[model samples]
Target: MSSPLHTQPLAALRRQLLSRDISPADLLHSVEASIAQHDPAIGAYLQRDFPTALAEAHRADLSLPLGGIPIGIKDIINVKGQPLTCGSKMLAGKFISPYDATVITRLRAAGAIPFGKLNMDEFAMGSSTENSALQITRNPWDLTRVPGGSSGGSAAAVASGTAVATLGTDTGGSIRQPASFCGIVGLKPSYGRVSRYGCTAYASSLDQIGPMTRSVADAALLLQAIAGPDPADSTCRRDPVPDFSAALQGDIRGLRIGLPKEYFGDGIDPAVRAAVDRAITLLEAAGAELRPLSLPHSSSAIAAYYIIATAEASANLARFDGIRYGHRCDQPENLRDLYDRSRAEGFGPEVKRRIILGTYVLSSGYYDAYYRKAQKVRHLIRQDFAQAFAQVDVLLGPTCPTPAFKFGAHTSDPLQMYLADIYTIAANLAGLCGLSLPCGTTPPTAEAPALPIGLQWLAPPLGEATLLRAAAAAEQLLA
Candidate 1:
């Protein structure tokens, strides 16, 4: 039997706790029970400390916004005293965070108990958790398929009822894609809306931390706790944090929703296209105006995203040299040999591929042609959204081109795997806030069960209030 605590959303648990119907300790135990029952099959968690979590729950102050709620942290995010592996051999057993990420500090202030080290793509490089050097995280809905990553573990934990909510970082579609695959809600706040301080950097310009939860309201609650500025993250915006939960009460009547023509064309799976079309129709029926618009630069998004992201990743990952904290070579003949061997040994194949691509793009001869041009394209992509937002309140479309794929399907072709993020990377490149929520599912085959489809909504930077309001209003319709 599933624990009631595990099955309920964060808001429901908060209400129950406030009413004295369930204690925080009870919630913790329920989470433990759920993890014990489901984690073996899903492989969502890298490590969990139930004793520490339980103790915190027992002492939790229920009055705080997130008091006693155990929020799972993606391996890339730092939590004081916890293992800080980015799902690579480099830091697996070697690194312990000496301080909390700003987000962790915010969560703690909101009374949330940070619990486990969730699995992720090594250095947040891949779209599937298969890149994790530790273990593969499978989709809870269909174990044969991948949980879209590098936030796969976070999404699986929520989808499998092992976590009420969790934090996932998005550089491209890390949070939103996994949520789409796992049939949950994932939000990637606009760049600088949330602090990046202490988060292991992937592509610095594109990454943003957000919440993955079972419901949009829960996402709002969690986002409320974590969305704010911090001096520690100079990139974090100083915009006033609104009552995200309160924004949910607003209706979408007369809201202008944009349907980017480019997103509907070509490679999208027929089922995914149909489902998202239905979602747009439903929103239209719900009093939203569907304006077919164009993000003309959309065709260049994937190419530009890879070039810029990899280039930034090349620079960000240079800090992991053998001498400091991560894995070191056994015995080095020289410094160069030590550096080469240590990195080669620590990083997975996918990580190495990205680092190499990044390095090549930023190489002296290629910088102007690739990296610089990609940055220019990135600006044009952002301008595309700026122009679209002038005509609409939000942009709506399919989150992923297809539902979760079976394991090993794209492993042989790295480019195929890269295309899995085609629909999502633009939001990051444009530095816009976006969300993914379950809209419907594809038809089940004799050999395969129906997999969930997701509809994504994008808002201008710091426009999460408008984003959440529209999403909450559509949640019931989509359901």
Candidate 2:
């Protein structure tokens, strides 16, 4: 028989722990058993420390805020004494984190246990876990399809009942896209809203760590534990964190939801469009006033995002050059050869591709033409959101253009894979808070399996309270 705790939401599990109906050790064991039974086929974890987690569970304090919940950490985030591989062979066994990230410290203070290092795209550069040098994490909804990435493992683990909740980093839709694909809830807190001190940098300006859970209330609970300014990170915002759980109580009676006309264009899949349309109707019926809006710069987001993200990636990934730690070449003919061979052998294809593209855009002569032009366009995109927010409380749209695709479907075509993030890249570009939840499901056809559809909600910076309130109401009405 399955453990009832495995399927219970995070809020319910906390209640059970408070009532002494389920002990932390029992919860850990139940998760371990589920992982042992399901993970080989699902591939959601890169590494797990069951013994350490078990030891922690035995001494857990149930009176704390989290009630000893077991949460999965994305491999890119540092957990003291654990392997911080970032799903790349370059740092695979070479570096053990010497300290915990700020978010990990906050989680521990809240009584949440960091249980495992979940798989991700190597250096968080790809749209699918297939880019991981470590393992391929499959979507729990359909084993043959990808759980959208680079946060695929976190999403897959939660969807498969191996975890109650997990943390994922979003650099251009990594968290929300996967949550959409796996039929779960994922949030990318506004840039600077969550500390990035110990997270492996992807695109520093774009990456924000957030929660992945089965419900909006659970996401709120996790966010409350980790969202605050950290002294170690200069980019972290100093705004006081709000009571996100309390925010979920009020209905979105007078909320103004903007439906961007650009998102429903010709390229979107028919099923996805239909599902989002239904969601808009449901929200409208529940007292949210829907208005058709325009983000004129939306079409140029993908192009600008690639140039900026890759350029930041190129600068951030220079630390892994095999000098101090990480993998090194056996014997170098010279200093140049050492740098060349080590990087070539250490990085996977996708990482190499992004690095090269980034370097090209940042090269001396081309910087003004490509990188500068992209930055100018990025400002316009942010301005577009600013104008839209002046008229609406939040913007609503489809999370992805389509449901999860089969493995190898877009592997050979980088452009195709990049376009998959068309609907989500703008939020990251604008540095706005975004959330994705299961709005509906597509029917199975002879050629494709049934898959979940997600509705994305975007709010201005530090507007998580409004975002969660609106999302929770929609979740309840949809249910």
Candidate 3:
């Protein structure tokens, strides 16, 4: 039997289109068929407009790099005329984006079609896609397990062949953790590497938009299409986007990779450790050098990340009050009542918990004690990475503590859920580039199925070239 077109790598699909072996319409049909077959179980998409997507594909310019490719977008991103729900009832069915986000615009200009509104955590707040008010996104590999969040739907879609590639935002491991859980390549670019003008803010200082794909080369292609300085976003970097595709051609000979001692200490699953350790061994055998290093501040990453992220989320989400747009209280006893009722009715438990915590931390008496202290710790975390990068080309580690967990396993304990991203949050805090790709799988038991383990690597700001090169080499080695 022939493989599904949607299951093929983006580069292969693009080549077929260019050679007249497949048309954009054919690609769209393949994606639609996959969505029809798989999405009911995976719940990857919150909304899909295949009629419009097919129309766009029909007009796609095949000569363009991403031409005719359909990229699924996490719901938080603003795609003109599409729902921008952020997986919360707060904006669900209420807000339709009036303009394209810079990334969406760039994708269009590169001949890619933005096809679906993928599910996510409410306002990008949760560690599991379960926080999405709309639906639960299960790991494609295991129906009972969660695809990690807040980019879970993006990861699920890509893993399930519902999308050729997708866009996801990372604020404290949103992209990488999900990629790990879903067994795909998830790259979180440097904080300013991609414009955030159209993406809904989670943690302003840490949020970055990036690609989730089936392969490293596909990720490089998607990054090439969407990356560059954007004048609309003041926070976007002015640095020229490098040739990411070129980076993939290089080998990892003589590469210096640091394995932070703190990450290897404890709390990691034995299978996860073995899988990552094996990857490290492979890299070493391929002429790469491994050094044991310490990121002492890593222990405080979860704490600092929560404080700073929630603080920023609080400020950003305040705009959704029941007045101009989004969900609103039907009959307001008064202005305050409207605000209270709308927010209370709209937000889910996890989002409300975060907003409340954020509000308290930023409140008069606690600001200096919690929020300010967290920023200091964040800076220290960045310094730690700077110091480490000074000594090594990249840092290698597990993307998360374990493989994807069964749904409801960590739902009751938010702290346990938060710890799932222990290995990934620091990169966001430090403004470094990070990528996660599958290394190996755990041995399945009677109770659970075999699940993929992820190997992660981090690079300094704008060091995506190094990061991708290493990841591409690792991909080849692992394959």
Candidate 4:
């Protein structure tokens, strides 16, 4: 029998824990059982800490907000004494976190248990989990297809019912694309909205840690637990966090939603387009006003994002040079050989490609031509959103251009792989909050199984209250 606890939403689980309807150990076991049955096939977790989690559950404070809840953390986020492989051979078994990330501390304080470290693309560098140097994570709905990445395992764990909710970091579309492909809710909160102190850096300026869950409400709860300033992370905003769960009243009457013309044009799959279009219609019928808007710089988002993101990634990833920590080459000829060989042996192809491209753009002679130009374009994209938001409460689009594709589909073509994030990248460039949720599903074909489609909602920075409210309303209609 399917365990009700395993599939229950975070809010329901919280209520159950608070009321003593279910003991914390019972809840943990339901998740443990689900993981045992499904994780081998899904490959969502890289390391499991059931003993530690079980102990935590036993002593959990039921009166706390997330009391007794079990959560799977992305391998990039550090948990004290846990292995943070980051889906790469570089840190596999060698790197152990000595402290908890700010989010982990917040979750623990709110009474949640960090059950395990989930997998991801190596260093969060790819669009699919296929790039992970460790293991492959498959879509729970169709095992042959890929779960999107670099947050693939995060979305997969939640979608497969192994965890009630999980955390994922978004640089470009890492969280949202995977959530779309896996048919779950993913939120990429505004940059600086959540602390990044303990989460391994990808593109520091672009990355924001957020929640992946079964419903918008759960996403809200997870976000609430993690959002706020961190003294360790200077970039994190000091703005007071609102009660996100209480904002999901599902009433969005007269809300203005913007439909971006650039997002609806060329390259979007017919199935995905149909699904998002249907969601727009449903929202309109529920009393939202739809207005056609133009984010003129949208076309340049991909180019600028890659240049800027990789430039930042090149800087952030330079720390793992086999000097102080991480993998060290055997019998190195000298320091130079150690740096070259260790990196060569440790990084996956995608990570290497990005590093090279990033280094090239940031090189002295090319900095002004490539990196600087991209930064200019990034500014324009943010301005486009500012102008659009002034006229509408939120912007709507498809989360991905197409549904989940089979493994190896885009691995050979890096540009094509990057394009998979076209619809979701602009939000990161603009430093705005974005969400992806299941709106509909495509029919099965001879070569491909039925896949889920996602509708993306974008809001102004710190506008998650409005975004979640509208998403909750549309979620009910979609249901």
- Which lDDT values do the candidates have, in the order given? 0.93, 0.93, 0.93, 0.92
Q: List the residue pairs that clash in candidate 4.
A: none
Better of 3 and 4 by lDDT: 3
For each candidate, what TM-score against the reference?
0.99, 0.99, 0.99, 0.99
Candidate 3, TM-score vs. the true structure? 0.99
**In model 3, which range of ten residues has the least summed lDDT?**
1-10
Residue 200 C-alpha lDDT in model 1 = 98
Question: Measured by TM-score, how close is model 4 to the native structure?
Answer: 0.99
Residues 1-479, model 3: lDDT tens digits: 78788779888888899999999999999999999988999999999999999999999999999999899999999999987899999999999999999999999999999999899999888878999999989999999999999999999999888998999999999999999999999999998999999898888999999999999999999999989999999999999998999999999999999999988878899999999999999999999999999999999999999999998888988998989888998899999999999999998999888889999999999999999999999999999999999999999999988899899999999998998889999999999999998999999999888898889999999999999999999999999
Tens-digit per-residue lDDT, 28-122, candidate 4: 99999989989999999999888989999999999998899998999999999988899999999889999999999999998899988888999
Residue 44 lDDT in candidate 2? 95
Q: Which runs in model 1 stand beyond 4 Å of their true positions? A: 1-3
188 Cα displacement, candidate 1 (Å): 0.2
TM-score of 2: 0.99
